[model samples]
Target: MALPIITGFDKGDTMKRILTSIFAFMLVLSLLTGCGKKPVIPDDDDDPIPTEFTAKVIGNTSGNLMNGGQYAEAGGWVYYSSETFDESTLTIATGLFKMKSDGSSLVKLADGAYRSINVVGDDLYALTQDGVFTMKIDGAAGRILPGISADPMGMILVLDETIVFLTQSGEIYRNSIDGKNPKELADVNAYGFYYQDGWLYYGINDASYTIRKVKMDGSSTTDVSTGGRDFVFADKRIYYRNMMDNANLYSMAMDGSDVKKISDVDVNSINTDGRKLIVSSFTGVRVLNFDGSDDTVLSDEYAVTLSIAGDFAYFVSQDFSPQHNKLSLSSGTLENILKVRRIDPQNDVVMGSGISDPYIVRMGDWIVYRDSGELTKGIYKVKTDKTSKTKLIDAYAHNLTLIGDWIYFVNDSLNNYLCRMKIDGSEKGVVIDLPVNDFVMKDGWIYYTDLNEIKIMRAKMDGTLISVIDDSDALGEIKLSQDFIYYQTIGMEAGNFGIHRIALDATRKFTYLDDSIQSFIVDTEWIYYTTKVSENELPMQIVRMNLDGSQSVVMDYFDEYVNVIGVGDGMLYFETWKNEAGSVNRMNPESGQRQLVFTSDLRNDHTVIFENNLITLKNNEDGSVNVYLSDLDGNNRLLIVE
Candidate 1:
């Protein structure tokens, strides 16, 4: 699916070229066919269907089938289309046509690329390169539907007098038959839709793998199950493919209960004729009993899509030269055949937000980060192996912290409140009602300095049990140690400016660690922090104190105060000296030795460390910063995103 801006859709250069060529061809055709009778497209409000029209009962062949569902077999004929747009004439050649089941009697219904094809009464309705249109099934009197736009990213469904489609711009709109009085049903990245028994069901992937159903009136939406498109509703049961289960077949009751794995035979698309299922797969086209028994291979030719209408099922090949073939369901005979993304810093355009500090988080094998660059400004997740990168949600996000199966972050676009969603970008919701200043997670509890309250607060992972842990005027950030919460604090009168600690559990014991803490990080057995000496001439002090207050030792002194950025493996520390613009250095805690290993503008904050790697920013000459993932020693760097 082409994503919209944030939710934007990318038409890409290929779509542009196809449209351009279509326009060129259409101009010539119009010039050659001038003075010909125009196709009469009816408007229900103005040019209603003739009373003699039957609004026939031909099947709507759409699902996971190849052709993205632009093909259907009905009424002893197989319908197909391939059309394009004309920019100069501002017209869409619908390109609707059909052929006999045996590939004979070729007939053109309309012109150009068409999708969402449906046969109702004596006419056919479909979306062309430019917009929604309708025409007689015999390829006559066709006209564009009055206000509907073109190129919907997802399948469109016609429900009695109403029509529904997912626009490329990311909205599912419902309109009257004449394309009048459109109402937005939802904002979705849907691919398939079905209306049955007063309910409308659609397959959407914006959140999680889910098939959702809503009342025909657009009320009471409910997630049907964890399945994808190409599902079929028959015998009062919904047969769907569970993508999480290797794209295998499954069956469930109407209320989404009694789910049973029907078959382990994986498939790309599926169709059914009451008792048997016709499936398209890499292996070939096959048929089997409804329970997945008595499986039979009808054709050894691989098909990417499968569509059934009336007595036949049609499929397209997955080869270089794709052949659109038809099959007789009763005879099980067939004919016809047809046949990442990685990031490179040099050739690929690596964008940055131009902000010095890029908020980065490491979630398992994926690094989810925030970018504010002109072209790629959003929250995106890229695998550590450079195998895949996906935009999660199209919104301003920050402080991406991972806990359990969820990535917790502040929605900078939604009042800075803490929000969370699954790593797959599903089940997103605001975690806390109040704004969060900064936060740290331990176990399943979220400890943070509440921005509105300006005090240390604690809450469970689900945003419950919200309690004020410390009423003191908190400073800097929150850190989670083994048993205590470490934070900088100052009294209401601005006195007592230093680091303090409190128990993580119920005791909540508070202890004053020291005064004038330049920076600090908690360790398993000791507390490592930085403090400045009295005289400006004196070197800064690096202090290490035991958790039980056993002994205090000055680890070493630096020429200037430093910020303890992060603790790598063992007793090694990553730091930035001078407390301002300085080089990031790696320090050996046991020997008190430090070496300049990386550059840092500080952002004056702790860096993100996970999976034995660290993230840092490199400033470029053009005021843009490129984020890189580096080893603990600041070597073997890789660009984070493209």
Candidate 2:
């Protein structure tokens, strides 16, 4: 059982925090880390294996109490406990279960309020309503060790055959796996107690939460770091949240020397399988590689284990200074997902790629894409299972929004007018004979930013009954949510900037969130966004609000301004563009968890290579861009275009 808070915290309120953070977390389970600095492993791990959840990737046996020992792997099977709280009694309902390694053949082993589950040799050990309970792996011979009470926060820590533990009343000790021969380790009151590799790491129960460590036997107790939490040990490194650095995730040498930032989000609970790490924050539970790549939301709501099945890739990636430096922008070579010009009329810029235009969309196994390259400068649809590639339109298209049987897009080759074509390359015609900017389509209705009138316009599926929703301040990235249209009120000054939403039915219209809102995007559940901080210029906090514009929450913050690019592939993507040097952060829209995926440095040939669809942004002789969409193993050079 992963206690939501430090020992002194109320379990009831802690459970509430876990429930509230799910909204932002799942928004990314739909789409995608960085806490502060791009992950920098100075004494880097050697070699990157092909895939994840493998013995080679983790380089060990399957599973060991990650995520509060709610889950563990032993005897060729993975065991876990499912918990639910009953409000009447204010107690958790628990059930112990197991499954195959490949996520099949699930079976419930036992039923009880289980906590900090573990398995050793032929027996499975777990803390239940009564002391430590030992049961056979097949759910037989269950008995609790005598004399110990049913501590809800009891965690079984295995240290060289001797089980070490920290009590809820702030006492640390060593004992057997059978809960006998208790040897007191330390009498200090620790709030965040953790054990790894025979060492006990924790923080004092005070305002400082000063981090310290000791041996399992309570010897050599000394200060290791300052103001750290969520401590975990893996691969000769200690990872924790550095409160001094915006509460971003950081890792250091065992003796407390080489402290490097691992992630950007603040964490309350964490567990690592030596290779992949699981972290729980206000937003949601997240899974990422050691170097903080392939970071994605594992769940929307807080569970004992928000497990993400395999296909997670191995990561090999960076060194950097403590204070983050943002590269000033000029004319720099870069590759983006949906490359285009900035819609802000005041700025003349070819900004990083974003989803202001859906340059690519998938319908079933068919992929329809918009190309601006010289050779294939139009829209093309290809079938993944078959070799049927069709050039739907022989004209450049932007703002690609597929609605029903038609592809609604801005026809850049046709005076930048709004046009539509049948799903098959037939019945192509102009939908609206006006210049359009960013747009979205839904339920046979079209909403777009009309550059001609500088207004938010709407039209029917067949281009009839055109209407203007709002003609107020200039808008940026118009999105549809619930019954309202959420758009950005672009401005050069602080107060000028606001995210305004107008009801589609034209009944109500108002500015959303606050005036200091910088940039935002709306998903089905929440509006994920960023805001400018009063003290700092580099964009500050990433926040989210519900569709009705209530329950605004601050997800994560950065020392440097991070751009909210687009929401896709089960997560939101943010870009920290420092001139020619930039990195892309994948975020879980709900939980505010972030992981650095792609880093582009002009000096190197290719930078920060992760899993499948390796992103390579290279500059050509004529200041053009070339991107390679391939795999990390060099075997599948699948797709490449200029």
Best by lDDT: 1
- CA displacement after TM-score superposition, residue 489 of candidate 2 (Å): 2.9
Give the per-residue Cα lDDT of candidate 1 at 556.
80
lDDT values, one for every candidate: 0.61, 0.54
Instruction: List model 1 lDDT by residue over 1-642, tens digit each.
Output: 000001111211111112212343433442353311222224543422222222224237434222245666666776666432222221123456777766678776654566557766566777554456778778888887765543332355665565666655434666666765555555565556676566666767543567788764456788888755457777688888777777788888876788888778787667776668788666788888877788888887776556665566666555422345667777877753211011111222112111111277775687777765445556677887766788777666667776556677776654466777677887666667566767877766777887656788887776777898887777467777665787787554533556677776646555656467777777788778888777464478788888766778988877765666667776456565454567777677788777777776665333556678877644444323456788877799787653
The list of candidate 2 runs beyond 4 A from truth reads 1-356, 384-387, 491-496, 513-518, 565-572, 588-593, 600-642
Model 2, range 366-416, lDDT digits (tens) per residue?
Answer: 556676655556777766443577778766676776555667787765446
Could you estimate the TM-score for every candidate?
0.42, 0.39
**Residue-pair clashes, model 2:** 27
Span of 10 residues, lowest total lDDT, candidate 2: 315-324
Model 2 lDDT, residue 614, Cα: 39
| Clash count, one per candidate | 30, 27
Give me the overall lDDT of model 2: 0.54
